[model samples]
Target chain A: MEEISFASQLLQYTITGITIGSIYAMVAIGFNVIYNVTEAINFAQGEFVMLGGLVMVLFRVTLNIPVVISFPLTIMVVTVVGVLLDRLVIRPIRKPSVLSMIIATIGAAFFIKGAAMFIWGKDPFDLPPFTGRNPINFLGAVILPQSLWVVGFLVAVVITLTLFFDRTILGKALRACAVNPNASSLVGINVQYMILVSFAMSAAIGAVGGIVITPISLMEYDRGAMLAVKGFAACVLGGMGSFYGAVMGGLIIGLIESLGAGLISSGYKDAFALLVLLFVLFLKPSGLFGSAEISKIRKF
Target chain B: MKLPAAREALPSGRTCGECAHCSSSSGIRFETGRDLPVKKSKNSLHLIGFGLGLLLLPWLAGHVELLGHYMDVMVFVGIYSILTISLCLLMGYAGQISLGHASFFGIGAYVSGVMTTRYGVNPWLCIPIGMGVCAIVAFVVGAPSLKLRGHYLAMATLAFCIIVTIVFNENVELTGGPDGLAFIPGLSVMGHPLDSIAKYYYLVWGFVLVTLLLSLNIIRSRIGRAMRSIHGSELAASTMGVNVSKYKIVVFVYSAALASVGGSLYAHYLNFLSPASFDLFVSIKLLIMIILGGMHSLWGAVVGAVLITFLNYEWLHYFEEAEGMIYGLIILVIMIFLPGGLVSIPGKVRSLWAK
Candidate 1:
């Protein structure tokens, strides 16, 4: 192996970090949406991502469908699954406590993972890169084309989500519901519908993340739990309901993980991110961008 | 249960309503009440009977060849019983959920395993050392985490569990990595090594009995009252002079210590230590056990541990590939239909029948 310069190594780590961070950011955003409206952190969010990749593989590889068709189909299928989860599992509980809902989501996550294992047979599946597998060399570092796809999708999703939240009436309605459901219902907003929409949108976002990252990172049945944990760490680090916070938290976590892997023992890579999570939680639960009042939202 | 009612019915010179902490709606009035001698005697009789039964269980199992297979399962049930009971104290009494309890269990196992295997330390010394380490780690994790309400605290513990698991798998020098450490020495008392299954059965269940007694004493004490108050309402608990955070942390530490003790026994019994044995799934399994049996009831924890252990070892094994599916389905069905858990089913049925 050629000995690379320290600067080049740092640059390479940054690129890899951003790519993975983008995925985490997407997952975090998914968590933020449902949490904002329902105050339930859907543990199945990562499973949706896993489903996205695996379902896409099923459509494209097994069924010989085109990538373009399979991608959207995967997102749609996952979105429907998310909606059904809310309808069947979350909605039926008349007096849903936060603890109960959390456990319920965990059960859903396990169910989805088990179903995935049965369907996918526990092996990792790969997707062909959108363009090619060739690495583009920079001044001293190299980057994959798939990484560009990941970064690009993340940027697009963020912009779209920002626009959806700010400029659209439906987005405003969702935001209103999130802020105060009783007030929103009093003002004639359908809080239930908004919650359903949030779940669907969150699942769709997670699916996009899963689909794009599959080419770079292979998909497996049990991978959802780890992704969910990392995403949750990102969500907590970013401030639970803040969108921009989620993005920033994801990037910071990604950078920490990649840099730690590059500079220290790769074996302890995950520990670095977890340490940051613990520190942030212990010292400042509100996170960098979150308001102090956000920490006081503990209902039960 | 009836003793509290009997105490409430006893008319003393003082009015029970005079006590500020007494809630009239709960039907249990607290006064300077005298102990019911008859009730005490009856309880002691029941206790003696239960103790006798527990003592005779191993002897009966030894004589019956058909029951030999269950000796190992019963030993594990004792281990899980400790974990579930501790979880019950935290979740049922304090209204806190921990998704990473397996980390404490794993820490205890590793600490004892490493000490016994690497340093050749006595198993007796290792158990307490493991409990101490687990208690400190629990304190550090719980101090910050207990401040967060509900799901966030759960997530924090989950993150901590993930980090611990990673460390177990990555730090090959300390933990034997994914392959794990083996040849851990069995536990002994006064150098009499508990090598046989029946001996381990007695040893584990003996600890279980002690733990249950301790837990029962705590639950019936003032500290338990404060914990129950916190579960009802933290703000109310604080207003009533219950140091809410202090009790939460103390209970969390106690629970971790119990799990650690169980882990030490597990490591010695299995004569091996692996990261896989104490993964996130183990924590979830423990949670499910407590939830299924009845999170609030002490005996419920024991029942849950035994039933779930049987389900995992016997029932689920038959399904093989569908294990996760069945496990997930059971949790969902229970949470949906019987949120009060198996312990409450009898009461629920009685109420329904009355209606």
Candidate 2:
């Protein structure tokens, strides 16, 4: 590795951190949405990213489908998957003990992974560049169009989800459901449908996240588990229900990981994320934007 | 057949609550209390079986090497039983979830590893110190995190578990880095270095008996009642003056301490320690064991631990590429169909037979 100047090194690290943070934020956003209404963490949420990228790879490489068709198809499949997940796993044991529900989510996570693995082997599969194979030099550091794609998609998703949650009638209903399921049910709002919607929307966002970023990081069936952990941490660190907090938490986690790895060692990068997670939980428990509702959200 | 006879006694038209079987069978058997004669007779059979196995172990060994393996497994099972029992109480009784318990296991291992490897501390002294360290860490983590109910608490512990794995994987100078500590000196008990499988087996069995008794005692005591109340519903428990949060912290810390003991035993028995063994998978395995065995029973934890450990050793290789898939599938299937786990099946059968 070439030794760069300390000033340049610090700048490089920060840029890397922000780019990674952007990806985490996107993943976290999906976590926040599902958690907000349904109280299911959607453990398979991260796999939407993996599946999107994998589908793109399989179509473009294995099946000879063009990127244009493959990407949209991938997004559609993931949405359907999200809906299916809600219908099958989340809805059935919705009345079980809290631990059972959590176990069910975990089961869903594995089931999805197993399906994905059956479809795609254990190898790390790659995708053609979303923009181009070239690197851009806008940040006084190495930045790829894919990095910009990730950041751009994160911004777009946040804005879109924020509007959907805050301004729309459906969004209001969803929020109402999250705030008080009993009152929402009493008021004739379909709590089950709201939960299903939440799951579908979260899956959609996660799939989009996968498509945009997979061009940078190669897709694998197993990538979702780690991503889910990171996403969960981001939501937790940012406060579980806060949309903006999930975004910020993702960014902060990404930054911590990137910078921590660059300054210290890459080997411990995961530990850094885990440390931040533990610290946030142990110290605040509420996280950056976490509110009482994060804890108040009932699994039972 | 044995279970059918046990079940034929329940009243034909009544559905007594879930505890009927537990009360009849275990009778809240504890470290100190009246030993129901019938329960003792049943339990004594197992005790006698264990005794015979211990006596015949050396003769059956036929070789020193296989004997060592048996010793190793026993110690692991003993330590794991301790950890599993703690988790059983916390989740099944106290109504909390932990995703990061392996971190405490690792913390215990790493503490003992560092003490013996770096500081030249005796393994015996280091064991308690490791447990103490893990207890403090658990308390620190639990104080805030435990306040959060259910899934959040699980996630918090998961975070801690990941952090510990990360630290153990990295931080070479302090933790032997990721390659893990090697050539750890054998542990000593009562001024003798525990070096043989027969001796170690006895040692581990001793701990298992102690932990099993303690856990059963707690389950039968007033503390156990509070834990059960908490499990029923935090609100109801709180309404009943259970001091829900305090009990949570207590169990969380105790579970961590138990995990520490497991970790300590694991490190000394293997004479080596690695981050991979104490990863989140291990924690999940522990959970699955407790869940599969029947969370409501103390023996459930023991059964789950032994069954999973043996199964992992014997059959996991068959599922190689899809090990995780198999594990998740089995657990899902068990939870979906069995609901209460294998232990509950007997009760369910009894109820059916009553009909």
Query: What TM-score does each of the candidates earn?
Result: 0.92, 0.86
Candidates' chain A TM-scores: 0.96, 0.93
The Cα error of candidate 1 at residue A34, in Å, is 0.3
Each candidate's number of clashing pairs is: 0, 4
Per-residue accuracy of model 1 over B55-83 as CA lDDT, tens digit each? 88878887998777788888898899988
Task: Provide the TM-score of chain B versus the true chain B for each model in turn.
Answer: 0.87, 0.83
Question: Which residue ranges in model 1 land beyond 4 Å of their true spot?
Answer: A1-4, A297-300, B1-53, B63-65
Each candidate's DockQ score against the native complex?
Answer: 0.52, 0.40
lDDT of 2 at B37: 16
lDDT of 1 at B141: 87
Candidate 1, residues A43-72: lDDT per residue as tens digits? Answer: 889999999899988887889898788888
| Model 1 TM-score (2 dp) | 0.92
- Per residue, candidate 2 scores C-alpha lDDT tens digits across A1-300 of 345566667777777777778878878888877777866566677777777777767777888778788877877888898898788777666246567877777777777787778778788887777789788765357678788777888888888877887899999999998888889999999999998888888878888877777777788888887788888888889887788888889888988898888888888778788778777776777787767664654553
Q: What are the per-model C-alpha RMSD values against the true structure?
A: 4.6, 6.1
